[model samples]
Target: MNNEAANILLVDDEPNILKSLGRVLKNYSVTTANSGPEGLAHALTTRFDIVVSDYRMPEMDGIMFLEKFMAIQPEAIRIIVTGYADLEAAQNAINTLGVFRFINKPWNNLEIINAVEKGLELKRILQENKALADQIRQQQARLNEQDAILKALEAEEPGITKVNWAPDGSIILDESDIDDDFKF
Candidate 1:
């Protein structure tokens, strides 16, 4: 979960904007794409921890780009950056596209850095949680299997004494406690 190791994608049609943002976010691994189609192509080919895209671009807008990006990489964090501060676009980005943050064109360097850092942190947390859940599921499956085996053994030996684990870790199936009148 090192911030420096996280991969980020920056999509903007303006070269200067891309350059400036790239410089500001130089600490992390940043990949830039000129347009929505290019960004979408890169998204399909590579995995990114975060994606910051401009709201207005040729062929496809930021909302559409983010929506498609979500389909391809649902786990990637999405952010929208644009000079045009349209309320509708911001709402759409958040409500429908699930954008992590909406940033204006004259963004503060500190704010942008913080947003990326937080996004990466969130991604790491989600990954860890998923792994822990999987491990729990695997352990539960193993316990269920053991329980089934014990039940089968009990069905076969109705009056059999409970099996114990010896000090040496071996199973001790002692039948000395069985009543004398009981058959094998």
Candidate 2:
């Protein structure tokens, strides 16, 4: 079971809602958390492709949970599952938390599955971009290190004296009489 198949976290205060939605979105690996704190804890420790959180909860609302989750797993796609459709909070959630989608409660089976799939897709793209950027940075660092090593080698070698105007720009010391420090 490769991770690309999509691992999801379903967070809701209602057990029945979680179970029903989990069953509907059975295509992916689903983990259910009954509270915002529990969900955030799981999210911090485990790797999930997407996090689907209910909008209203006792300890924390969906937007609040999403904000904390974003800090831990910025690349994880956050989907709000809520009955409340308050426009102001939804706007804030999008602006601050960067939620991928908002799904209403009593959700249609097909819509939930679709949202999960799309969220996973976005997460994969974000992860891939981050990996590519890291690889580039590492490669650049290696090149810089190699360049420094070459300069150090050039400076230490007595035979390699730079004659700026000459194409083959260097004085070569005779092999036998070379200083011990200049031996390569």
Best by TM-score: 1
Per-model TM-score, in order, reads 0.86, 0.74
CA lDDT, candidate 2, residue 42 = 96
What is the C-alpha lDDT profile of model 2 across 49-121, one tens digit per residue?
8899999999888878888888888878888978887888888888888888887777888898888777777
Off by over 4 Å in 1: 159-184
RMSD of each: 3.9, 5.8
lDDT of 2 at 155: 84
Give the per-residue lDDT of model 1 (tens digit) for 33-83. Answer: 999999999998999999999999989999988999899999999999989
Q: How many clashes show up per model? A: 0, 0
Candidate 1 deviation (Cα RMSD): 3.9
| Stretches of candidate 2 exceeding 4 Å from the true structure | 1-5, 149-184
* Candidate 1 positional error at 9, Å: 0.6
